[model samples]
Target: MKLALVGDIGGTNARFALWKNDRIESVRTLAAAEFATPERAIEDYLSALGLPLDSLSSLCLGCAGPVSGEDFRFTNNHWTLNRTAFRNALQLDNLLLINDFTAMALGMTSLRENERIQICPGEAEADRPALVIGPGTGLGVSTLLPDGERGWRVLPGEGGHVDLPIGSLREAALWQQLFAELGHVRAEDILSGSGLVRLYRSICALDNHVPHLTSPAEISSAALAGDPVAEEVLSLFCIWLGRVAGNGVLSLGARGGVYIVGGVIPRFSAFFQSSGFAKSLRSKGCMSHYLEGVPVWLVTAEYPGLEGAGVALQQMLDTPNAA
Candidate 1:
């Protein structure tokens, strides 16, 4: 029997699972910092399951950062992998490495209705592309395009680093401070986990309010507890996320829908559902109506990246000329 392993590796954590019978099993998440290299982590995972290292015939990793060349270094961590060295070490017949967000885009294929929370209700045009944007350690953006005979093709880019769009006078004021301090304020600068703290601090400075919260969790907790300053920060964070999501949809014509997948939003799902996000998303001046029927969903699946790794692997192994 041909056995395969799939992994969704990020800066903070690395989730691994066995791919069998078209599903994921024996799922495990390991701290990225604990292992010297990704290979060691994989070996440790297999060993914990009492499985032989050579039992796996194929390995697929959906890793953070650009995937190319023989030598691959993780973006947020110190781990690196030499593809040829890894393939030889593992005695694998096939090895595939994909951008973590590309795997995230592919993971949307397996989402069931209950697995997602609808942020905006509308009909999805199945033939059009879908936008997948989320924030964790950083913001990630990718487009899932219909490939006709090829099923789906993922278009991955550093859309997170785009200029931060200003929507209101208050936001413009915040931007001025951020730009003054950081020089260039990218979308990821305000939409990520750490970005949440940055936004909170900047807001405090603008309002002459002493910042009582220093982390995303603390800010979110304070917001939920009805602290005025924290509440404003969380609200603006969601609104800005909406603006960015709107931009992505317009750029890709992603009427197939929008899947918001990441760690940050899900932390405050209820707050996000009721925030100004919906209104901000459709706030485009003349093109507002263009986004009318575009559906948006917040993904709630626990291991989507790992599941997407499996999908990517299957696609690659089945296609003879895939590159």
Candidate 2:
């Protein structure tokens, strides 16, 4: 019956809610640009919810960066936090901070039967490691390692910043072009929201057409409206995503399931379903059969970050050392 405050803090938005009695209540999302500091945003959310400061037993935050000691700075936003200071200010017994992808990996545990849709066909093994990846403002990667009776523990890292691998002659050309312009073409270079735009522009230039730079939404809309260039961008995006996912699966030895959790994937589900995703995933030369039985699923749960925070807090409370 413990009450906790949970937040999924990202580059663009910070979502807050109260986890009470195994459920989230008073969920609210605040624009990161609207608040100068994280404390200010917390205060505003608390005021909006009319929640008492003393009622919160713990505060758990899923941040979009590497957490070191008591301080962590957001990857996309300008906000920084000193965890010890925040805990003291809130007068809470505990504060938990974890990488955002770690939150997503943990969030997969709370997913409902109806909340997820299978993309690739496979027989997922029970008690095996699970991988969760997504592309939004940036690409994220994390895996859930089964810890026997302790459940799954999240293994998070900066996998998205790794070097991108080109699968074809066309991709090689695009990669060279991007490398020339950006000095280094990372996996996130053409795998994120801004990457969608970059792909569209790169295609425009490749075909000797004037590139009208647009947002990811515009590109998606244009692709749906029968724009050949936009369609190509999405197609390329899906292919790359699948290839990277396949590599991720092999690297992590993930057999339970591979969960796709991000804002961008759901936006173009139909295209992703019909695109070269499955084919590309199984296209790995020597390891083709290794991923044959590993299932791929898209996470459609609402407010998974908050739920993930709740899971982290429950784990903390369960630990004997915490007592």
Candidate 3:
């Protein structure tokens, strides 16, 4: 069994690791901006490990964007790749590219007890689909369903770009302002890391206060410190996240469970768990019962996408014809 390289590439950082014996090793994270191309970043990672580029048999990446055609451009980063160019450049035999959230959804299969904390308690029905979503540099959404052969299949989509759903007068007022300012208010407009700041500023605008927080981290910190304005921002973030998750659940019939995995939510997990997320998720009129008994968990695994990339790579290797 030859070693394979797996990566989880997001807007901010690129993480690489070696997959061997069904585990991850030689894990290294590189800032995407530091290198001109992914190949260079991988080469640096390999060089630090005292390994040659040819040592690896294959490479699989979970990137933050759509995966298609011979040419691929990253959604959040400046790096782009031509499949033929990348393969020849790396001198690799096999290469697989998948949606980062697809890998994230697959990562759910490998979560341990401590890696996940339950946000909504319910029974996960066997054979039902599970919803995997996260908000980071951008929002990501994917679905996971049992393959009936003891394996799992991932269905990836751009669920983040959907229209922002409004459920209350407060949200409607905020949405109106966002629409007037931005023209189009997608869910990602207020559901991502930058979205936190946008939501904060919007609330500030509504309340006639000057904005104090500039970044997601600062806003979360202030909220945790009992700042009223920041607390509203964080609370609204969780509520909106719940709305999006609930909508996803309705679309995919995700009765298996919901896994919220991302960089932002974990920053203030305690506040998130205590917010109106649950209420908003189940607040759908008439169809509210559809969400009953579906478990929801917050994933805190550091590198689930890396592990998931490895899983996807192994599956491809096992079935060469798999698309």
Candidate 4:
């Protein structure tokens, strides 16, 4: 078995690890803002390992943006990599780049039961498509299509930028408030880390009161500390997550299951699980029965992206016509 460098690169953090013994080891997390470029971060991570780059078989990175061939620009950051630059920088031919969400979806194929907390343990029919959506710096969405013996094929998309739905008066007022200022509000506008703050601000605006700008972490902390406003904002975030997830379930007919993992939801697992999330997911009238049977779970595994990157690399190497 060859050792490989694997990474799950997102807007806020980049997780890197060495793959060996069919798992990720030496996992390291780097704040994206601390490095000037992704290459710099990679070099730093590799340096900490005290290993020569020549010993690594390949570099498989799952980026936050769409991967066009070997070129990619992170969706939430300013780093962009052209194929020539990456190839020259790494000096490896087995490089594989995929959407970060896609990498997460790939990781699900080998998910252990202990790694997830069940929201709805509906009939988990194998071979059915699975949906994985996470909210962090931005909302990430991807699907796992059953690809027979080869493995699960990842379909990554910019689903987060889609239209947001307002089902209640409170939600309607928030949309109106957001739309008045931004001219448009995508699902990500209120579903991500920054979105959590935005939700807080919008809630304040709706109440005709001013709000102190706060980070998502602050809001989460405040919510856990029993701040009514913070709790409301967090509740709304969970509510919308359920709504957006329900929409995905409808669009993909994802009967296999819906796995919710990401920066935001995982941090507030108890709140999310007990919030309106499950109810919202099954609230699709007429189709509620269809969705009720579709399971929704929260992936609690650490370093899922690293695990996924390993899976992707192994699959690529196994391909008969791998480049």
Strongest candidate by TM-score: 1
lDDT of 1 by residue, 71-120 (tens): 99998889999999999898899999999999999999988878899999
lDDT of 3 by residue, 16-70 (tens): 9998876688899999999999999999999998888888679999988789999
Q: How far in Å is the alpha carbon of 234 misplaced in model 1?
A: 1.0
Candidate 1, superposed: residue stretches over 4 Å from native: 321-323
For lDDT, the strongest prediction is 1
Candidate 2 lDDT tens digits, 1-323? 34688899988999998877766788999999999998889888888867666666778889988877877789889998887787877778878888777887888888898989899978887778888888888898888887898567998888788888889999999887787789989989889999999988888877897877589999998898888899999999999988888888888888888888889988888888899988898898987999887899888888888888878877887787762
TM-score of each: 0.97, 0.95, 0.95, 0.92
The collision pairs in model 1 are: none
Computed on alpha carbons, the lDDT of every model, listed in order, comes to 0.92, 0.85, 0.91, 0.85
Question: Of the pair 1 and 2, which is ahead by TM-score?
Answer: 1
- Give the Å shift of residue 179 in candidate 4: 1.2
Total clashing pairs in model 1? 0
Query: Ten-residue segment with the worst summed lDDT in candidate 4?
Result: 49-58
- After TM-score superposition, what is the CA distance of residue 99 in candidate 2 from its true location, in Å? 1.2
Q: What is the per-residue lDDT of model 4 for residues 1-323, given as tens digits with 9 covering 90 to 100?
A: 34588998877788999887668989999999999988788888878977755566688998877688656788787778887787677667688888787889889876788999999868877888888998877888888888888587987888899999888998998899999978989999999999999889989988876776489888988898898899999998988989999999899988889999887877788888789988888788888888878888899988788888889988988897885
Residue-level error in angstroms, candidate 1, position 8: 1.1
